[model samples]
Target: MSDQTTQRHPNILFILADNLGYGELGVYGGGPLRGAPTPHIDGLAAEGLRLTNMNMEPQCTPSRSSMLTGRHAIRSGTYAVPLGGVPEGLTQWEITLPKLLSDAGYATALYGKWHLGRDDGRLPNDQGFDEWYGIPRTTHETTWLTSPGYAPELVRPQHIMEGRKGEPSRELQVYDMQERRVIDAEITRRTVAFMEERARGHQPFYLFTSLTQPHFPTLPHPRFAGSTGKGDWADMLAEMDHNVGEMLAAIDRLGLRENTIVIFTSDNGAEFIKPWEGWAGPWRGAYFTALEGGLRVPFILRWPGQVPPGLTSDELVHGVDLFTTLATIAGVAIPQDRPIDGVNQCDLFQGTSAKSGRDGLLVWVDNRLQAVKWRNFKAHFYQQDTMMSPPEKLPVPFIIDLYTNPREEEGKRASGWVLEPMLKMVQAFEASLVEHPAIPMGTPDPYEPPRRCP
Candidate 1:
């Protein structure tokens, strides 16, 4: 067991950033935009594969739900980030990435943000993770709880919850700056420790190291503070890269490089709100919109012997596919009892194909449809100014030729051209509903209070 060389399926480590934009890494031209270079992250793209057409939902909760379950957020009842004491998150009907992998003898641990559910029945431990050590809500909770006139009950709900292999999950304390400032570093430390610990064991493992940096109140660790000289965003970005380097180094140190598969990506798109929030690459909108800037993000994967080095692919892969892809890699079948939106994308992982199994992606915010992307075309049926703003459904759908207008700055290019393909997409999506009916949006009723009263 100590050899680290006798493994069948490779160990997988999936790292997700909170509000990382597509343009913050060195490979994505963020080196010139942000202050410090993301050499460690960029080196990953150079060593493995950098996905140009990776698609996902535009918000954190939905995106994470889609990634964990091989299904759309609409099906899992976790369509958006619930706030203000709202009881919403992943329902028990859904199975998750860690649960599936754990069922097949793989040790699973979630070492960071677990925004899927809040209550006991809906949390990471209940969902499938073997151990959970991270925040239970969005990064905004800390700020919201600390704001003026904030309700006591509504504000201080989140904390550093820890779920170990033997003990039950419990709240450690109220999340504070003492924890928030070095949260990313702590996640890295735990992830490296887990990897080193597992290297001595016989069982292969799956670790989801979800870092909560670059979200709002972007605070860099003390060592990285002002080192970027760009701003809080720059400082945070550099700190995140340094943290990734530590975990990568641990894998190398334990001689787990060959059998380990490391993945780096963001929860959604970039944060485009603050001067220190960061840029969104060549796309429009950010974080919580239906545009490319919110959906299109960087996806990098490194596997020494399986995945080819220095390869780039422009295929259509969605975050929903993580469940199916890893299931295939682990020699386990995706759950056939339920409808799965993800496909076995290991072909693209191994450089065997230039295409993904998915031909289109659906953009859903809360319960309503916002956009539909088929092939090279993007069709928008809704719009929102910010995450807090209500999305307005348009009378006519706007179309964008993504190949020519990847930024989505142009308005309605050949609007009628989307009708046929959109109809086809709608038809296919509706067929899946026959078996697993789409769950209603999990937001509180209209009579219920808003998440935050302005």
Candidate 2:
């Protein structure tokens, strides 16, 4: 924002919404249309920079891993959400964003879902967060308690857990349907308290408030149930907005608005499951697919005096970019020992340049190269319209110009010229893999990447 402001690290409050669709927000053209009015979230867009073409990995674990590590999930061995019973998550060798920030003397905490890992040494506290309090896995696990034929003795129930760095994470309670409904509220409350406490100190803080809402079993809090008059979906959406507004109000009340960077985004596109499905705005497909609907999600950043207000950019931005961008903003140096896929987007965020400093990225769905996006065009090697549908591997990669066909329905008619750049992008990534190599899935700790000399 200002030269003085740039001298000191600013507090970062990143609020991640699980399975929030692009068009679900009013600013993105789905609020009222979707029977949910997001006044506070809409106001966030007006107050800061919004990216229309923000992209993420097709699934929760991959997207979150990419964001935290600044590397593709394939490289981190978190390419997919593990069903359970495995040593899954980032290796201890991986330098996470919170770890980086914490190393720089910031108070770091995550007050929601920490799906990266569920066991010791891999939990949020062990991964650089000073403290963490949330579920070990997804919100849908809460359904396991109510689902028929579920045997608790066979599969240990998911718990609402908490931990401090250098300590074993302790289970707090069962994350059941009731806990699911009120978890977001608890996350918000802790987040607000974290901000208030950190504001009193000289050290800046990095608080990641991961709200588990509108995902599966999209239950609204008791206070918000029937508040929307539409259904549980609409009510949950309203609750999400209200929770956001509460945090924004806290920032203002504590006078941290000018010195804090507030970010709002989703883990993926939208939920595709029945009875709890989410709209992807104007796009087709949903999470777990390579289509725009699955890869593209809503992204809003509010840095009062630094980032330009009411600015919407269609230039490509990915969830991985958050790691590099925030590192730059906090004056932290990223690791150079490994390949980092995220590009520095400081200029784009500050509105200093129109380009996003990135032109394309490889699209992966569970360790498989599903597609490649370059500029406004994408080449899909596999087609899976929705999460429920089986992916069809095509003999020839289908291409689509997103500007003309956002729905990707006329991919057969796409120009052949786009194939060159798309393939080149894919080839470049594959080449990088040959040198640095991707970490194999379920890689154990005490890992060390091979070193190659020029």
Q: What is the TM-score of each candidate against the true structure?
A: 0.93, 0.97
Question: Which candidate leads in TM-score?
Answer: 2
For model 2, state the Cα shift of residue 40 in Å: 1.0
- Candidate 1 matches the true fold with a TM-score of 0.93
lDDT by residue (1-454, candidate 1, tens digit) is 3344336668999999887888778898787577778889998888898997888888899999999998998877678777635667877667787887888778889988988877676778877888888988867677766678888665455688987654567999778766788888888988998887788775689999999988877888888888878777778878998999998889889988888899999989888656546677777778788878788888999999889999998888899988899888877767877778888898888999877787888888777788888888888888675666788888888788888887676463755866787878777888878645776556432222223334
Instruction: Supply the global lDDT for candidate 2.
Output: 0.90
Error of 1 at 357 (Å): 1.2
lDDT of 2 by residue, 1-454 (tens): 3435434989999999999888899999988887789999999989999999999998999999999999999988899998765687889999999999998888999999988988988999999999999998899988888788999997889999999999999999999998999999999999999988887765688999999988899999999999879999988989999999999999999888888999999999889888999998899988998888898899999998899999989999899999999999999999998889999999999999999889888889887899988898888898788777788899888888887888899524578798887788778888988988888778889889877886
| Clashes per model (N, Cα, C within 3 A) | 1, 1
- The 0-to-1 C-alpha lDDT of every candidate, in the order given, reads 0.81, 0.90
Give Cα distance to truth, residue 272, candidate 2, Å: 0.5
